[model samples]
Target: MTDTERTPAAATGRKQPFDLGTGPGRVLVWFYGVFTVAAASRSIVQMILDFGKAPLAYVLSAVAALVYGFITYSLVRGGERARRTALVCCAAELAGVLIVGTWTLADPSAFADATVWSDFGRDYLFIPVILPVTGMIWLRRARTA
Candidate 1:
């Protein structure tokens, strides 16, 4: 058995690139992608249909969509800088969810409709609330690994 034959890559059959395509990253990317589309389209449609009805909610949804889009892109980019950017975005996302969730609850009349993070993302199965937390954790792990 030569040294080349005993390498980790050889033992593992092949060496896969360290990217969001690997392991939990794959799932995270998928979820972020879905949310990006969902939030963007929803906000666009809502704004077009009746922006005056819920300007705050609709604009917030659009902002959330942009954030999701950026995070998704960062994750797919898959590098140290991307990981750090994603981590920052994820923390901002969590903060947005908490702030908006509390605001909506505190003053129901302030929001004519629900944003993606409304009710702690109850409308979206709480994924908006949970995603950032998971993303932060994943980004931290990916950075170390």
Candidate 2:
């Protein structure tokens, strides 16, 4: 169906103000949830399997996972601070992926194992590399809308 013909009744309302965690926001929320689950699981597995092997990398992974979880929470909550926090978290996530991805590439021996940032998240189909960019775009759209 066409856009005009397919819209739901709730979407044709007079309450046109942007609801960041509703409608399209719901899709972002689902992605954030998935990221939270993936990051948390990876961190937990890394820590459990071999923390002593690469303490710094594993700890950073855990921190990144926690940050992802917090971002997920903030997106679902939907407020000024929540949006701001989401921005900051997305920026940090981008930075983390870049720095770690570069480092892992520059010296694979140092990592000695895979990380979310490794090879630009080749293992995760590069969603870790792409998510922050998409998040920043979404956040900006949400803010301006």
Q: Which one is best on lDDT? A: 1
- Range of the 10 consecutive residues with the lowest summed lDDT in candidate 1: 12-21
**How much is the lDDT of residue 119 in candidate 2?**
78
- In candidate 2, what are the lDDT values of residues 1-145, reduced to their tens digit? 8885677656876333455677766777787788778877888888998888887777777777887788789888887678888989989998999999998889888886677677777888998878888878888888876
Please give the clash total of every predicted structure, in order.
Answer: 0, 0
Query: Residues 4-62, candidate 1, lDDT per residue (tens digit)?
Result: 66787747676534585479988999999999999999999999999999999999999
Per-prediction RMSD in angstroms?
3.9, 6.3
Ten-residue stretch with the least lDDT total in model 2:
12-21
Residue 102 in model 2: shift from native, Å? Answer: 0.7
The residue-level lDDT of candidate 1 at 45 comes to 100
Score every model by TM-score: 0.88, 0.82
Evaluated against the true structure, the overall lDDT of model 2 is 0.80
Q: Could you give me the TM-score of model 2 versus the true structure? A: 0.82
